[model samples]
Target chain A: MHPRRWTEFAIESLIRVLGLSSIGFVLLIFLFLLKEGLPAFLQVPPENLLGTRWYPTFDLFGTLPLILGSLLVTATAISIALPLGVATAVFVREVAPGWAREVLKPMIEVLAGIPSVVLGFFGMTVLAPLVRETLDAPTGLTAFTGGLVLAYMALPTIISVAEDALDAVPKSYRDAGLAMGATQWQTIWRVVVPAARSGILTAVMLGMGRAIGETMAVMMVTGNAARMPTTIDSLFRPVRTMTATIAAEMGEVARGSTHYHVLFGIGIILFVITFVLNLVAAGAIFKKRRRGGLR
Target chain B: MRPKIRVDHLSFYYGDKQALFDISMEIRERQITALIGPSGCGKSTFLRCLNRMNDTIPGTRLEGRVLLDGQDVYAPGTDVVDLRRRVGMVFQRPNPFPQSIFDNVAFGPRVLGLCRGRDELEEVVERSLRDVRLWDEVKDNLKQDALSLSLGQQQRLCIARVIAVQPEVILMDEPCSALDPIVTLGIEELMKRLREQYTIVIVTHNMQQAARVSDWTGFFWLGRLVEMGPTGDVFTRPQQKLTEDYITGRAG
Candidate 1:
């Protein structure tokens, strides 16, 4: 009670510093993007968004191809990651024995720790070449290849977080089901699965964010050409992606030129897409806050 | 009367450490059998072993014979799933599924594939709920989540879930430990009524509860059955000194 003034002062200043710094950093990045990227929208002729062409050298920079490619690769990656990740999570949390769990858990954590560049290389050496030979296509770098790489790349985040979610389910629920003659699988599907639904959703959205924002991996595996993502059933074909386009173009463009602004614009678009996903992921997390998993 | 369940030379071990020592007992049909003792007496352990609930734990081993109506429950070919279907269990805490009250009751019937149609499932749910005396209260709100119910009501719902599959044996491990006095009495009355149709085995720490409910009572001490007889006789004149001391408050 006697030191109320000092305690209050210390607490207030510490919180203010942390809170303000977070907001300040966010504001600085957005302001930079706005200043450098806003002019592209106000060009003498507004760029066509739904078109499939991007010709910056001839004073024409339409982002439709890059946007489509990014969307295609991200969607493909998510479709692959969702099932594999959730299944791995279920096996690890529910079915795996103690020794296997002890061995596998660290293995998954190690997967998470593996640098994205190495995974990119794996796609180049193993996945992409395999895709090329299987599909009999010209090149391995394609939207499908990027998705496959990103799936293995984002595996740990989805599985680890979702496993934690499944593990959070109260033991009483499982026991009650088991006591009522529900088999192990039934208990998981009917009780544990439903209870961990919100968490799984959160994990999916988080994994989506991880896959979509990935630059180096997608850039390496996906053939970096500013072209439309052509229809291909297999991953063994070349496809251009938005992040790759921006990263490729940003280095060569002169400062304050229209091409540079277009790259900045692509950066802004990428940022916004991930921003929206983060908002969705954050909302899912908020809804799941009280569910506080298993026992 | 013939015994519904007979345990002969039953011993339980967690790996090498023994928990139950040379326990033998007979449970009659349609009667409440209370296993009563202080903590660490293996009373709860013995109750769980009856339904093979202990099998869920890792590194646990059991020896000897547990017979349900002359069939060896621990036989090499005995299907644990089918065995569990006939022997129901209720834990100490009220463990209602996160789903609706209706789904909770329907869980067992659905998993066991006992009912074919929605109408038949509804009948089982209704009958089970009525048996537990929870039908009228939750009949209209059956679609509502189970967690919405009060603690006592949730416990009853758990009972309904067990009874839906129509198990002949019911094993309760300190079923009322988490309930208040009023709820416990409600449960006690339910158990009294249930015993007329199903064999009921309950493990309780409360001495007076065993006297009030059980027809046959077994007193366990440290990992052995100290005494077993009619509840009235055990309460009035326990044969073993340890049982008498425990009943008379001389020692645990």
Candidate 2:
């Protein structure tokens, strides 16, 4: 028996153990969420979750407002972030030259690396004031401010994802377009952008998922009123999202109470929204691969 | 007509490194001129110089005249777009856009605005695809993805794309390097057919290919034009010691 073969065996066993440990951790998180979330649903009746009003204090937790609020905030954030984020990504990857690329890349990295609390504070101080001043409102914290902050926070993800997507298109594609006598701008618009469509979709969906899952930054900005929004303009008003509801009420609501259980239910809603968004991202990636398949 | 191209004491520099020397050549109208040399002997660089494709690379400077039909291609007033449109190029790798087979053939015609109506455009595309002998195989599958084609088919598609534009001159940079022997022969035959209408210049490492396909052969050595003449003269008779050793397989 050679010592080299023993070394190979050891390395192989280590890789297997490491892979299983990762899977075990993901399984643990899924099981924990399922176990804690399932019982609360069983204890709380369907009318409590789906009925007209939302009042969970008397062993009846209606989840309508929280669900609506979460949808509103996530959709608003995505609407604002997508265009600006993708444009910045294109500028950084294509239009920006050497010194600009060097400067912009690290700045985006720092934006991504900043602590969420610090971002929340910045949102609290800067963005909220801007929104308040523009809207002529008393409260700086509103859904608009929260959405702005989340867009700012998710900017790095969108830019990096879209940049990687644009970069993955081979240089030959660009060269082919150029050699066809197409202008630079025309080539970028017609050939490069269309080729990167699925990739850009994935980036947008990933950013959407991230914005929806965001907690601290969004919580610090949105006014957290928990009212059912009437008009689209009211999106800028104080609104308590599901995550915000959980954060604001989970501690005060005692254990086994309907309010506490409903907060847990809000967690389930947030998890579901994020899960759907991620599934959309995965589907876009699959479609891109299918279209760009090896023949 | 005028000579299709003229190179006089043409030299090129890649950064501080010089790639082409005081090499001069002329491409007459409707002729297939083959450039042959060992690897890294500036043959490809000289071929690229014709269409100013080398302008894409930064820090590359050229001091020469690349006159297409006596019009200076290096002249500042010369529009690169118009020049490239008139002088199409095909790469060694057969790079077709990730598009439908029809779109790939239609790309150049669309860019040049060669046809106004859809029927005329389709007719041109069909004719171009037929010219390279790929229309019969791909006519039914025009809507299929270009990437779905095999390597040999893709190379032919690229050739079809160049002809679709109806360019006066075509530059082929080792077009058959990535294909099998049968495909290479097919392309060689296609080149024979294409030479009647388009002036073709190609770089090939295969000496036999140059001998078989080209009327004129230019031998490059260490960035210098060692010798150039009719393919028969270069292959049968020795003009220079280097050309003799190289063609005879004795020395590079």
**Local accuracy by lDDT, each model:** 0.87, 0.83
B-chain TM-score, candidate 2: 0.98
Best by TM-score: 1
lDDT of 2: 0.83
Model 2 CA deviation exceeding 4 Å by range? A1-22, A58-64, A136-140, A290-295, B110-121
Query: Which lDDT value does model 2 have at A84?
Result: 89
In model 1, which residue pairs have backbone atoms overlapping below 3 Å? A168-A293, A168-A294, A169-A293, A169-A294, A169-A295, A170-A294, A170-A295
TM-score of chain A of each: 0.88, 0.90
Q: Sort candidate 1 into its docking category.
A: medium
When candidate 2 is compared with the true two-chain complex, its DockQ is 0.44
Off by over 4 Å in 1: A1-23, A44-47, A227-237, A288-295
lDDT of 1 by residue, A197-271 (tens): 878888888888888788888998998777766655533456677788877778889999988887788888888
How far residue A92's Cα lies from its native spot in candidate 2, in Å, is: 3.0
